[model samples]
Target: MSQISEEEKQYVVFRLGSEVFGIDINKVKEIIVYQEPTHMPGSSEFIEGIINLRGHVIPIFSLRKKFNFPEAGDMGKTRIIVVEAGNSTVGIVVDGVSEVVMISGSVIEKPSSLLTSTVDENYITGVAKMESGLVIILDLEKVIGRDMAEAI
Candidate 1:
């Protein structure tokens, strides 16, 4: 297989609240419409629950709850972004799924100290400057840490 260079990377953008975030397109498996997942007792608060997708059980996580944002009431635009990180396949709930875009490495900047402190510093890989506005790039593995990844 041919390797894709860092500069040629593409991202799947999604919105959590008013803020926008992006994940490497390579890590995204698929995007699915919102569905209520079966609640699992003793699971993390951020994790909505588990859902059976094509016979495979997948854990569903809520970005809003994880980021401590106010609960969202609208489900019309909500989407479950199924992403593959390592050997685990999980889904993250986002307010909406935005368009995919290619962002050159040169236009990506390290997360500012202010941004890192406000948002979770651990998950942010960088900030990409787009014509519309800035988009935060997230590292999937970091967002769902090793422990959580393995557990779910």
Candidate 2:
């Protein structure tokens, strides 16, 4: 069984278009300013492009696109969240990162079958109830899925 201890799990919250969401801080490698990524032909639609991250050619993918949201240009504090999923590291673009929050295992609740929250349940492991509301905890594996090619 996958053991989920009471250890505090940090999460970074951000907005995807309009909805607010979050991912485990452990998955977020680093936060970087928005940069024009170099295009790589024959890649998936969600794969925005790649960039040379201090000698490491990191491919940046749009999380919005992956969730079927309309594309938006870098206007505000758009950033690339370096993440490791399925043993592969990749960059996920977000509107802006709010703050790193700590959530214990006991506080994490199973996803409610709320019709409004039906977008990507599989990519979500649980929901963290917060004073603001509830922050969706994403599943790292499902977010990256099979994007090993671009990640490598």
Candidate 3:
């Protein structure tokens, strides 16, 4: 059987366009300034390409494209949030990364089924209610998908 903990969870918040989203802090490796990735032929459209981070070649994907957000204008605010999912590490491009915040798990509510029509509900673990606004918590595994994660 599985158990649920009431412990507070930390998340790294980021902006895609006008919307703000959050990812589990444990999955995040690091956040770096945006850099143009080398284009790879015949790869997925969302896959911006790859970059050599330190010594490792990491594939970078556009979270805006994946989420159907408009292309970013200012590169200055852009950032690449490198995250470790499963056995591979991938970088996700975001408009900007805000401060990390801790919130009790009890404050997270399961996403409504209606959201499935606009977004793949599987990608969203839950919705966190914050004083500022609602923060959509992303399930990195589901957001990247098993096939893509394996390919990375």
Candidate 4:
């Protein structure tokens, strides 16, 4: 029998309000500054709709609206963190992208009670303590599960 090897993953960290959130780095394709998204009528409000990304019409998602955060107007450092969700590639608008961080499967921990009240802890992989404070590791698949659901 062959021994199962753990897969390594990288994460791209970005900020929502003051809190830091990280998504699978592999999901990220590129990051762009804020640009108005062409609205898709009848689509879910969370989806900011498609944008012309390098001649490819890629949909954009507002993470703030996704997590139910109060609307923040005109961020000086807003960026679109491009992510590929399943078959389609999409860009997610975030406040900004911090440096990429590493986390091994062995070090990943379950979300604590603190995140539960804030948002579903299941959406969080674990809490990473940093000298700056704490960074909440996010589960992109669970959070963006709605996209595929809507397609059906």
Candidate 5:
């Protein structure tokens, strides 16, 4: 089997409140325009509900609520990023997608212990230092949680 090169990694950068965050590009299936989700009874607060994508029912999650960020105001730039986590295809809502960046593995550092207070450290894989700014790399598996993924 061919191995993935560690020399560089591509990430899909997005905004959450004032901070920037990224996810592995390979995990992202597509980015779609924001649409109101149909609320599901007895779902978690972070779970914005589900959307019918083509013939598939995809669960939508609000990253702002998941990260404890204040509710967003304008919806103009909002987007739903469809990602594959485990066996589930989930859509994560973000303020907006910035750009796709390819950064060398050297610039990525382990998450600092201090960040645990602001956000769950388990959800963060690393912090990437880029020319634009720091991007908090998220562990999609942890963010999507095994149980939640299975349920969806």
Candidate 6:
């Protein structure tokens, strides 16, 4: 039981197009319904803009656009997952949030070279082999860090 618990990690699963991705649950703050953000002029293309959440203005980025996926129009199922990336708080827009699942570390595998070449490998932590399908675990810090660095 101890061994199982040690190997199990909780992830917040979300969808982008048909692909599923996950982030460490501990990094997530909250999930909110899709809301149009106030447009910020001269921001990055991937940035949807900023929204005031409980008095704190949080910038929202579209994972689909960042990943170069085609724009999906299913706004009803869309969600914004607020997460802590490095020292700052940011929100990532996903197609939809599925569930929080506990996956065993033993079943997590290093991402393949093909996948790495397609998408910046730095963003990928690992790929979890689930009974339904694979869930790519993302390092949001690495993914958002580059953009933040560029802005600075």
Q: Give me the runs in candidate 3 sitting further than 4 Å from their true place.
A: 1-5, 115-117, 147-151
Query: How do the residues 13-72 of candidate 1 rate in per-residue lDDT, one tens digit apiece?
Result: 999878999999999999999999999898877788899999999999777876778888
lDDT of each: 0.84, 0.77, 0.84, 0.74, 0.86, 0.84
Cα displacement (angstroms), candidate 6, residue 59, comes to 0.3
- lDDT at position 89, candidate 3: 90
As for candidate 1, its clashing pairs are none
Off by over 4 Å in 4: 1-9, 104-108
**TM-score winner:** 5
Clash count list over all predictions: 0, 0, 0, 0, 0, 0
Residue 87 accuracy (lDDT) in model 3: 76
- In the predicted model 2, the residue pairs found to clash are none
Number of the top candidate by lDDT? 5
lDDT of 4 by residue, 1-152 (tens): 12112444677888888888878787888888888888888777778887897798877877788778888776888999887776667778888888887755554456767555667776787766555666777777777667635732
Q: Which window of ten consecutive residues has the lowest lDDT sum in model 5? A: 1-10
List, residue by residue over 39-140, the lDDT tens digit for candidate 3: 988788888999999999989987777877778888899999999877789999998998899977777777887744456788888888899898888999
TM-score, every prediction: 0.91, 0.86, 0.91, 0.84, 0.92, 0.91
Q: Check candidate 3 and list the clashing pairs.
A: none
- Mark the regions of model 2 whose C-alpha exceeds 4 Å error after superposition: 1-7, 113-118, 149-152
Model 1 score (lDDT)? 0.84
State the lDDT at 149 in candidate 4: 51
Candidate 6's C-alpha runs over 4 A off are: 1-6
* lDDT for predicted candidate 4 compared with the true structure: 0.74
Per-residue error for 85 in candidate 6, Å, reads 0.4
Clashes in candidate 3: how many? Answer: 0
